[model samples]
Target: MTNPLFYAKILLFGEYGIIEDSQGLTLPYSFYKGALKFSSLDSEFEKKSNTHLTKYADYLLDLELPKGFELDVQKFQYEISEGLFFDSNIPQGYGVGSSGALVAAIFERYSITKYNPENISKDQLKNLKKVFGLMESYFHGRSSGIDPLICYMNLPILIENKESVDKVAIPESEEGKGAIFLIDSGMTGETGPMVQIFFEKMKTEGFRKTLKEEFIRYNNACIEAFLKKDMNPFFRNLKKLSNWAYEHFRPMIPESIFNVWKKGLDSNAYYLKLCGSGGGGYILGFTKDYEKAEKMLDGFHKEVIYRF
Candidate 1:
């Protein structure tokens, strides 16, 4: 039997804002992916993956999954003992959904009741997100399940709010100079710690007010403009969103990216924001001219995910 592939994901918008019932936009990033596979477990990497899977299997066995969603834990354990491992290139702690792809792959292969990703209903998608949240929490300590949900669906997901999520169609990439890209920070970030920082910041009434009034407003506007293919408003709101992150999400931003994040705001050549929880993973960038942004961001590893 052939194993299915699960792709990495990018939470393009609404990283911390989503927890506040704000809208979010996420898309599958096929550049990095993972799949379930059998290995001899000779290499340290393979052995490590197998060991993690063994522990994960134990967690799943004790997980109280939502009704109508079930994994064949016995089969999962048997496979783990048989040297089953996730073969993936998705960079861990990069905020590109590494563990998410692994979770999606496991659910794809071991779920006792499966819903077709191609034709799933809105309720099914919500249920799947709930189940994924429970499963992936074993890794992140706490999870919103959005990452695995995007990986499993392999589609752009628009989170209208906490209770509303559905597949969305994004404007297709064009050959124009404007682009959306990723910049590697040369360090790994822990989602748990970054999230703790966010929660801590949330305790401040001023932070909470700004997040709802300014941050979410810009984020939702960016999503709406991007979906409508309105470049002017998209970039306008994107700049605001980027600046908001720069001012409020400083702790989440790694030291290496601090200067460059400001440089974009000053130059108006590009804007940078957290790819996921920030701390040190990949930083998301937007530019009207990829060439200029490339020149300004020299020495940093960059990959363009979308071009306008």
Candidate 2:
């Protein structure tokens, strides 16, 4: 009955680079969340979701390989059989961690080991990412488990590298002038194909060079500057990261928002980045001046997340 909701997550920085051990900053977005509930799943969406969860439960049981992230899942099977399903509004395939939230909810409700503080360490986060990656891989072709971990912990997490993650405090919204917001694209994104495209692009020397030299540099620097609360460096690197994402990661961006994304970067009014794996869902925006950005985004609905 009383299942806590796991919110969606946004990978603020470090997208493809995170796989190569780049630094990442992730935050929970509560605007969309999922919670386990008992209800008559009569609607098509509800029935399909319930059925998918059943299959996922089976997938969890079927895993017998060596796993760094293991959990006692027998209890979860029992719950799954008893009408356990996540009633969520978070749209799947939008790259906003829809399946990740569900995976976290299941683990939080059923995982026997409580690795909160004493047992939880960076090693544990790695183990978790591995296990969660396997578990969530049932939903998507591949996963990093970072999204599920963010949803499970319900805390902002900073990825020092692929092997380490730690809880972080977000800077306070003191002045309320600058803001972070999301612009909805109203379309779902496919993860597997997009990832394939990225891999193909990586095979090209020029693209790979840009990814390593420019994208990684700006993305990693942004993480450091943001964490250090060095405003000037943070904004400076944000612009760079935003620009890089626009140029090289255009395929991942939604076609509808491409123009707005470019215009924002060009004008320096606001810079847009992929909220998740791009394709669609919500595009995250950062601007020193929200009113100006809002005016620029007049046609689309922009939801303010934070201000500083």
Candidate 3:
């Protein structure tokens, strides 16, 4: 039997800003996905995955299981023994929610109370986030559960603030000149250290003021404009947000791409932002013209995610 597939995700906006209650928008990126399967041949990768899964299962077993949450530990162990492994292509540390897919797969297969994304109540969603967050914290040191949430739901989620999140509709992809794309930074990003840097910066009053006054305002405007399909306002706010990130979140941006990022703003050909934690990983890009942006960004890899 073919197990379910969980797709990767991109947090289009709101990297560290979300921690300060800035609005965020996340969507599943089906181009990359993962699934759980039995490795009949038990190859090295499969064996490694099985071993990791066993350890994870053991960790879960030690937890004081919460009410209404049940994991069939024995069954999970049996599956691991049978060489069950996560077969995935999502790149770890690229900020595309690799572990998130694994967490979603585990929750779906093992959780007795299967919570369907469709029509799930806000309370149920909140509970699910807590569960996934705790489970994923093993990998990230800390987690907001947003990554796994997007993978689990496979839907676009609009984060109103730190407190409220709900599935939201986005403008339909259309054939047009403007596009959203991902650019490979040619390096992987670690979430924990990058997060630590953000927290350290938050210690300053200046950083706090910039986060609340400038970052959140533009972020909220970008989300609202994007959802409304108001491209002019979306790009306008996006440019400001991009500028803020460039000015303030320099540590998060890959050192190699600083010139490329600034070139976009200078030329107005494209704008770049963090796809995830942004120490390295993939850098997200937006452009009014893909062809022109490609010309401007020669010698780099680019993948078009959505066109408008």
Give all candidates' CA lDDT scores.
Answer: 0.92, 0.81, 0.89
Top candidate on lDDT is 1
TM-score of 1: 0.99
**Candidate 3: regions farther than 4 A off:** none
Better of 2 and 3 by lDDT: 3
| Tens digits of lDDT, candidate 3, 1-308 | 66999999999998888888888999999999999998783488888888899898888887655777677778888988887999999999899999999999988888888777898877777777778888888889888888999999999988777767788999999999999999998899999999999999999999999899999999899888889988898889889989999999999999878999999999889999999899988999999899999998898888899999
lDDT score, candidate 3 = 0.89
Ranking by lDDT: 1, 3, 2
As for candidate 1, its clashing pairs are: none
Residue pairs clashing in model 3 are none
Write down the lDDT that model 2 would get.
0.81
Model 2, which residues run further than 4 Å from truth?
A: 65-72, 117-119
Candidate 3 least-lDDT 10 residues: 63-72
